[model samples]
Target chain A: MIARNNVVEFRTDLPGYPWQIAAGDGETWIILRHKARLPVTQIAQLKNITMKDFNWRIFTKALSKTLFQGTVSLTVQYSEAQHHGEELPRETWVDEHLARESFIKDETVTGKNIVRKDSRVKTAFSSILLDKNMLNTGNESPSEGEGIWHLELPWQAWLYGTGKHQNPQVEKVHIAQVGLNTLLLEILIQLTANNELDLLNTQLLEYGLLPREELIFKIEGQEIEQILGVTVQRVFHQPVYDLESKKLQLRNFKEVDIIFISAEKGGERILTASRLMEEMQVIPFWPRDWKRPVDFGLFNKWLGLVKVAADQILFQGDYLWFVRSIEEMGTEKITALEEKRKNTLVAALPPPRKKPGEKWLKKDKKEQPQSSISKKAITVRF
Target chain B: MVWQFSSAGYMRGQEARRPEVLPQANPEALPEVTVEGLPPQVLSSYELKIKSAERKSPNSWLLNTSQGEYLLRELPDQSNQAKTIELYLQFSEQGIANLFPLEKTKSGKAYEKTEGKLYYLTHYRKGNFFKGDDISHLRLAAKNLAILHRQTGGWRKEQGKKQNLWLTVKQNRLRDLLAYLHYLKQNKVLTDFERLFIENFDFFYDQGQESLEHMVLAGQEEAFIINNLLPENITLLDDKLVFLDITKWNTGPQAMDFSLLLNSYLPLHRWDLDLIKDLITQYHQENPLDQKARHLLLAQLRFPRRYWLYSHQYFSGQLSSDELTPKLKRYILECYWRDICLDQLENWLIGEWDKNDSKE
Candidate 1:
């Protein structure tokens, strides 16, 4: 089982000792040791792993003791091997026959008749073989593609009677390894590579699990059209951003990662990165290495864990600046927004005298229907 | 109007002693009441007088008298004032001096009549207005209010009408909000804020409707409730707290009193549930709440009155949107607290009820 520190260790009654998985400096390592000696190391670079590099197999056998006694045995093997070579040397084989036992619980049903053969084979091979021709000729130059033996052989093995006699009586054995984190890490790396990290973060923030920073955007120029396009599709229509007026500054943000770009039509506006996460509908797998109270150090660690491409860090300063701006701008535009709101309201209201055949406008009101425009001296109540 | 002049023959000075022979009433000089229209008896009665008059729904005088300070005021509804004063008099008889406007006129009438105008004098309760955010004061006030409510519980003769008073108030509030929404829509130009309000009108309107329905479902019995329980009306009398105004007393659900006081005291958009829960629990300890009462209380709180009030005022031009914008945002933020308060109250109520159920 994996510990809180992400270290994993498991033991099996196999030839080797326990297997351990650990992370150091964001790199994961898998270690296998044999009875306190002979340690084999495998580096699992989660960012580089694919589905084909991992495999495991299971084997089972049964032994008969007496007329009604039997024992089942199970073994599991896991290996990560890369293709290096194909053929090997084969020598001699010895076969021995053994007696079989018939045990039947039912009177009419007997155990199947079985023939068993145990084969012992021995073979020897050398990775480095001396060439006698080169020794005799005393050749000073080395020739390529020259080896002691270049042999290719096709070999096959089968159990007699559909492998019934080959380890046939064993039950089930469960074998599992920590491979999920590797796959998840791979997906995250891929997403970062595709520049979709912001999108994923956006989805997470939208789920509303994490705290969000307040951001302000001044959507104007052609951005008005862009905003209207987004607003029109919503089920509930609000007239908040549907204007094609001046450089209208609107303040209110769902998240902190925001960007504003100028375009020819109305200017394009986008909320990027940290703030982008706010609009996310689904929570993404956290990219951070450490748990909560996430600060700058934790964020940097997360970036390292995700192995964010070096090019992305160039914009890190920009992201930090944007976040800082959001923090500084808190509650500043509230007053201005409110002012603009009042102006918009006044602009939206009709002059008391302008409405055709309006009865609510009193005789005195009709004389100066719109009090706001009447050059009336302002009164300071406070 | 019994205008007490300088007692019948006291001013007849033909055989009176000279100024030097006459004994001085005060060795230390008293401030002169020099206004031409002054009542002669008022000047003679109070030695040290500092008086001012201000109109606040009634012609009232703030003056220092020989007896003590007093708020002399006229009443719009003499009969209602009499009824409330009678209820308070009974409460005072039970040692609930914190309630009941203190010290009536010598005639025992809560109000004295002058030119057919009914007036009354109350000894100025020495204390500051309930202005601070100290929730302890709120807790104390709530406790006293619950006591006051329970003590005067049986004063209402019209039980059926009072029982439905909360429902009527909610219905009226919802009606008012609707009217304001209509007024907002009637404007020719609308701001983004106004538009947003209109868009979310149904959601807010539904909250009002739901609160009313919950009140009806709870069906709590009514008690004598202070209908206008503004925080400013509460005064700290030395160690004791008292509500100075009994202008709008009515037979209503006790929950109305709780809602009024809370709505008045809680800071804008900061509905600290701990404060609310503590206050409620403190009050409940004084006067236990039944399941129905708890439900009614929650229902009363669930209505977003501040948001509605600010928005209504802004749209009606009674207040400039710009002037109330910060306040509006505050109210909006406070809106979230309503749900939190409701959820917590519901949990506590359920927990308490379950414990009671197990005991039974």
Candidate 2:
């Protein structure tokens, strides 16, 4: 299994952030642990500082994708510099194990009642990834990049999510170990389909798996033809899978260990060690939108479990992710979030509601809670 | 001849440890194969007359009687691509050239897939492979080829698609070669000889291309074969040279056949232009070769180690290293890229002489 997901930023808290939600069984995730004062934009080296800025994607671009081979999800993160001193908040998964089998039916905490959400990511950026391959000890290496990195398919034993793959079968079975920041080599991949358009760019950029970096093979009963170099240099922009075809017909692969091999002139022998199961937990129900309020049916479920400090907002949901554009917020987001020495933060959140039917408009909550004002909806400006 | 070499055949004992890959229809034993469709009289003695002609390929049996010979090729349980190639050879131009038409079953099927595998029976051609001294048969063989090419020169439409019989120097391969040349130049693997080869290649490839304009043509975008000349397929019978598989674009650049023969013959007899000239004159008299064709042929005199390696692996099964033809070890070294020092066309030809000298 190859891990692919970009994390834009990791900060404490901000107003009106976007998040996303994706659903699948055992997907390779790029889960990021929010660390402030890290030397990404500041010193460009490892150092410790603290900032209580909220890190998340911009509004309007939280996308939820289904798996390719089987039913699953994949999230790709990016960065947008336009957002200034205020960006979105860092993503944290609420332990799904806490979800009681009877929780969803409880009307007060239904899914439709959550406050905010994100649908897809607009900006590409550096991120820490988490996948299902690691143990939950928060021990995993983080990947940094702004480019989309799609995995070579069909995966072996593990299932893969969506990045416009041809096969819409739901999940891809990947047999190999794939952790965050792990690179795999000698993975012979063909288009999951045989379409003229599908094959147009399957062998270039990230899509091209041929002439892999490190491989060992020879014809039977012939002199060992050590194929040391690639006949062609192929890479791909993005791999497209059709939601129509339920098959992952990627070609066979020769396993090559590239741990010690040179990066130049070798068959595909490198493995991108990923961190999914270790540092990240797949939230059972997270918001997948920023512009639109969480559907009335689903929002209630999110508002119930989110914990908060002074300005910190920690809400966990399943298969949901978020992202945003900096244009909405100014550059102060990067400055305020650059270097602060706080592990976490506190923030204001709507007071817990016992249930939707209970009349909360009894002149309360906000400083100017409406006195029985029923205008269908009132915009809550943060 | 059933290749009597160690590396060639699959013996019965090899499968002892593994479970017998029994036919799908009947897992207990070898399924009874009763092919239908032959003349009733031919079927009368089918089981009784059949004899085990190939002992190593145990499943393949031959049924022989006074009427004619029928070879039943059985598909083994394990069907790898190698078996597929063997089957192709069994059904392809090999058995066809020998004047053996497969027996069609009553249902007009070329083969019957018994238990998820295909097999067919055909009459075997009864003729010994022409040895080195069969000179008188060269003309007859050449005439047969000219006739075959003349008769079947045009492509055929099989299953509504055009079928070509010739193979070209695949353009992709040519591109690969050019790229390889660049790589050699870039990696400093190019030697003086290899540099000379580059010049000669540019010269001859152009010549070959020019001569081929009239003689050999490229395949169509839809489908075609060009430059399909190989050694074993070209035979001499009764002083006539015959090209066995002469279909579609495969029939052009007639010098290619002569080139391949020379490729084999040069190493067999080095330092003696007598035999070379004789064969040249013979081939020229039979089928006149143009100057461009001749120059291109000479330029191609240097065989790529890629093809050499294929041949070394092919013949090592039958002939001992000493009994093997000359220039073999050089071919091996060349295949491994160690003989790049002898990249010059002259060095390659000299390898034969060097081997002959060592033999002396």
The runs of at least 3 residues in candidate 2 whose Cα sits more than 4 Å from the true structure, single-residue gaps closed, are A1-382, B1-48, B55-62, B74-98, B132-141, B158-175, B181-262, B270-360
Provide the overall lDDT of each model, using Cα atoms, as 2-decimal numbers. 0.39, 0.29
lDDT of 2 by residue, A279-355 (tens): 12122222333232211110101111111222121222222221122233458866666444343454445545456
lDDT of 1 by residue, B48-76 (tens): 44443333443555555443455655555
Interface RMSD of 2: 32.7
Runs of candidate 1 exceeding 4 Å displacement = A1-382, B1-58, B77-95, B104-108, B157-162, B168-189, B315-317
TM-score of 1: 0.41
- How does residue B293 of candidate 1 score in lDDT? 79
Best by TM-score, which number? Answer: 1
| CA displacement after TM-score superposition, residue B223 of candidate 1 (Å) | 2.3
Q: How does each model score on TM-score?
A: 0.41, 0.28
